[model samples]
Target: MNARTPRLEEVASLAGVSTATVSRFLNNPAMVAQQTAQRVQAAIVETGYLPNLNAGALASNRSRLIAALVPDIAQSIFNDTMEAMIEQLSADGNSVVMSLTGPDNRRLEAQIDAALSRRVDAIILTGIVSDLETRKRLKSQSATVIETWGLPEDPIDVAVGFSHAAVGREMARFLHGRGYRRPHLVVPRSGRSQARASSFAEHWMADGGEQPSILEVNIPSHFGQGRLAFRGLTDLEHRPDVVVCGSDWIAQGLLVEAQAAGVRVPDQLAVTGFGNLRLAGDMRPTITSVDIDGARIASEVHRILRARAAGEVLPSSLVDVGFRIIARESA
Candidate 1:
């Protein structure tokens, strides 16, 4: 015969506390006195009591569950933000469920539906929802929707991000200031990367520089693609004097390939990259890159959720944390 499943009442009895007190402690430990909470925790462990979160959610009308959707987990750029957000949410007694939406709008919509069916309190998106129907459904839902990585002109509920176009334009100006005239951009075909590439090209031309060349690589750009991009650029009759990459991974690949080909960095070919990842500074001639504060974005998301939970209205729905150019040896 199987042992009976432990009960909440049994835990309360063992802890010398009422069932209501046990329930309060389970829902929010901060509500109970420290000593009492410790006793309740000890009793819970002894009885192996597991609270039914579904029942608690029904009674409280809040799931304390958050769903986070990202385009690609293989891209390490999202790691910092995700780690910080998960840490903050966990501290608040909330659990996070993550899903990869990829490039398909239908897949994204289906994931949202699944999260809603579970009665999640909030939905966090790595990027703005571009699909009209999906946006409408999210706007209609009671869940607090937050978009990160890029600021949308019309957010569903809240947005925390910087301007991709601004980053591109600033990079172009920075390169121009360093006297790099013949520049080439190696970027992924993704939407955000394309946005930056377009802005960079426009800004470069407007600032009296020649029309910059562009090479569109596959999405989720890798180091190999960067090396391939370098070869392609070098094969051209008019080789570029400088190369700007969409990511640090690509930049690192290019740097390694250039070194193998006996090309002096900066002196012969200047290089720059986006996302000031650790490798950017650690690599041999260090890469100049764009810096986005992933932690700040996560903190803003947590702040908005906390404020909403308290029934407080924020002064603004959009929070632009901004980006900066970290000039290093490569540029």
Candidate 2:
């Protein structure tokens, strides 16, 4: 019973299973039957043989792991945001797990189902859920569901993020203030990006500007696509004087494309991007972007989990960590 010497047999005896079975249940949980897993858990409670997650997760019950569902990990802004989120969660004694979603709708659905089967403690989803089936599956899991990056009218559970629609409105006003009448919205075809793109179009027209012309492309924000999407904007019967992008990745590509095309930025075509990544400031012309506070998002998520664990009803269902428009060289 030495404090430093915790024995598995004592825990096994308490859980009412052979030591060998306990070992498999903990190390190779997928091998244990569900009924047997519950028995081990009951014994552990009585004998106070608190086996770490290695055992219990192997048998049955929740995994002390939190899964962060990200569509693209290589995108610089999301990479940083997820890293901070994972760090903050791990510091609070939770294991951080990841499940990458592809561009395909069916693949994303399969990934969601697989994540639910694992029965993790919490689920953190990046972007909005467009697929109704995927959203239903996530809601059915009943875990601490969190949708970050964009806020929706009715989030399934908990959500912490900035409003993409508002981002568009503010950008239009900012452009108008700077004396830019004609604006073009360049965005990736992402779940949340569509919101920003559509809202930006409405807000820009409402602000007394002519109809907003939009250029939409695929995901991951590659430089080549940016060049193509922003191309011909200058030739749009009535050329747009400014461009707003879904993310800095798209903006970066737009900037590169504009430069290669011999168009001077800000002076010729002002560009604004979302998810103010570090590289934004370092870009040659220095991209002007909306700063979505990843650090604040991490802090708020941790605060919510702590409050929930203490049996307190979460006070903030919609947490706006806030966003800021950085006035840089590009815009």
lDDT winner: 1
lDDT of 1 at 284: 95
Q: Candidate 1, overall lDDT?
A: 0.90
**Candidate 1 clash pair list:** none
Candidate models: Cα lDDT each:
0.90, 0.77
lDDT of 2 at 183: 78
How many residue pairs clash in each candidate at the backbone level? 0, 4
Off by over 4 Å in 1: 9-21, 29-39, 103-106
Q: Where does candidate 2 stray beyond 4 Å? A: 1-51, 54-62
Estimate the TM-score of every prediction: 0.92, 0.80
Residue range 179-250, candidate 2, lDDT tens digits? 998777777777677777777778778878788877778776766766776776757877778888777877
lDDT of 1 by residue, 134-242 (tens): 8888999999999999988999989999889999999999999999989988988777888899999999999998888888888777889889988898577689999
Please report, as a residue range, the 10-residue window in candidate 2 with the lowest summed lDDT. 103-112
